[model samples]
Target: MDEQSTRFETNAGVVAQIRQLPVGVVLASGPFNYPLNECYTTFIPALITGNTVIVRIPRNGAAPHFPTLELFKKHFPSGSISILSGSGREIMTPLMEDGRIDFLAFIGRSSSANALVKYHPAVHRLHTILQMDAKDCAIVLKDSDVEFAAAQCVTGAFSFNGQRCTALKMIWVHESIAPQFVQKVCEIVDAFKVGMPWEEGVQITPVCESGKPAELKDLLEDAIKHGAHILNAQGGRFSKSLASPTVIGPISQHAKLWTHEQFGPIMPITSFSDLSEPLDWLAQNHFGLQSAVFGYDPQELATVVDTMAFQVGRVNVNAPDKRGPDTLPFGGKKDSGMGVMNAKEAVREFTLETVIATTVNDPRNVKALQGLEGVSRVVKGTAGIKSE
Candidate 1:
């Protein structure tokens, strides 16, 4: 068996604690985007905690996580782990309704989560860890180093084909440096080789072939229709791949891309006169997965750290758009996630708590009598006063 499929030997102490808890079968479900890594994150943790699991792999309009299923069968005991295929209804509904599944761990849409809560209310054992959606932002202060800032923004907004939830969908740039930053970012993105995933250092890959590009095209058209300008459009079509790394300039709130999770290679740049506007927008948004702040000013840096409006799982300080410091929790506020999930956090999520107390004697024990000394003194004083 592969290292991930086996029990996590390193977390033996934590595993011992979890084993003491009452855990039953769990249902793990999510899209099949990054099969090996994503499924490993959920399935391995669930199984290691002594909870048998039913893993529902994403369809992805393809083969439905065959590779991951094979891995599960190879490593897990019979009935300890089972694989389910198909969309949510055909697979998840029955699995969730089953009385055996004590909990459900999911990474999908908010609507789906609502339905689970409504239909399976009696599954009090239900525990959900979701990575719903996000309009993740990158705030660039005027003090940022211009060239380095451009490189970071380009990588964040475009890498992994903009498929990651942490990807920088919208960029908030101070007006003073907006023009130069936009030009430089566009230059870097334009020079990127958009090709097959196997190509040498290819930065951008296809999102989907059928109609995803048209959907993105419509979104861009809508932005332009409502007064947003395209800053960079230098990209080539490689067969059916959606490889274009399109970036827009200074989009208004009215634009759809500004308020939604693009989930593709579409970067919208929004200029901020001050941090207040972006903070206002962040507060009102439903999703809060991650945000990147680029600044050198100590005051501005402290403001980002202290701001309640930007409440999220992880906040990057002038770093690349990526998950950080494995020890840190990876989740979000309002709609990004239900609970934390990772390392020690993951084990805790799939566990139960029980407390046991043992005492040698009853309430009349010597220690208990000593505890009543203060009250006894008050009673004696009251009696003596009455007698006097």
Candidate 2:
């Protein structure tokens, strides 16, 4: 609702006003993981920028949104916000094919995003903001503190059962310190408390997606068959929806885990003889969301960081890869995703810049433009601007 306008006189004796305008109706869909937060990250920006939004409740976490229906009805005008439930294909296909959606804000897998985008009748006319798959990696250098690196890696890889898009899916440790780092990681994994989400000290909870445990088990077995060893004693233990954190080390490049975005509680580790091994792997990898490098030498870390910046969207020197703070740019590259999210970026993504120009000599045109500005200011005062 905040009206942004810039008025300036050009050398051509013309006065122009540049403003932001909504991109029309937006169809927003978020993944089951971080359902509420991710969904609002998309639709809230669109709504604030004057676009009507149609939100598709994710199949796994639909119940959490039921409580927000009353809030939406109270704040927005009728038909401004609509929530759709049921099978995604059944509801989304018609919306996309109808060619009414101007913006598509989706956070999920690449395959699902591709299918939904292809369903749109006029692809070129549709603007999309997609946050998809990521196989983020972490590299621990030989001179780094093994204990601290292991702790950071554990938190990054196993948080939310490794379902996060920014989670460290693969880890590369220098050959000299690989064994020590892997041992420390295994110890931390064993200490994690797995139980119901409501438990006071629970660190690992049941996965939301159905059959995810089985899928994770299959991935673990595949890595083992391809020459990786399960380092943790209780790793891969599964009962129904719960799967204990698993650590598989020295994973073969031929293993499925090497290329797959194992969005589960499975930590895959590998060792590198030289820095080139990890850097080359990153170059050849399809995903480019984020990467982490840990080392004591400033120059060594800087070299890796510079190389990783091109290969990924963000690089963490000694911390875990994360989306963070809500103010920073959150996005990926290549097969990982398209477009960016966060406060300012999301607003830009959901709106378009529009310019209105008039000849300075045209008295009538100037008067009309002034009147329109007055009306816009009045409207903004009455509705109050909303921002993220």
- Model 1, position 353, has a per-residue lDDT of 54
**Which lDDT values do the candidates have, in the order given?**
0.72, 0.87
Judging by TM-score against the true structure, name the best candidate: 2
Tens-digit lDDT string for candidate 1 (252-281): 788898787878888899898978988777
Instruction: Find the candidate with the highest lDDT and give its number.
Output: 2
Ten contiguous residues with the weakest lDDT in model 2: 379-388
Model 2 C-alpha lDDT per residue in residues 230-251, reported as the tens digit of each score: 9998897999999999999778
Clashes of 1: 0
Question: Residue 307's C-alpha lDDT in candidate 1?
Answer: 71
Off by over 4 Å in 1: 1-20, 61-71, 121-125, 235-243, 308-310, 362-388
Root mean square deviation (Cα) for candidate 1: 10.8
Per-residue error for 203 in candidate 1, Å, reads 1.5
- Cα error, residue 53 of model 2, in Å, equals 0.4
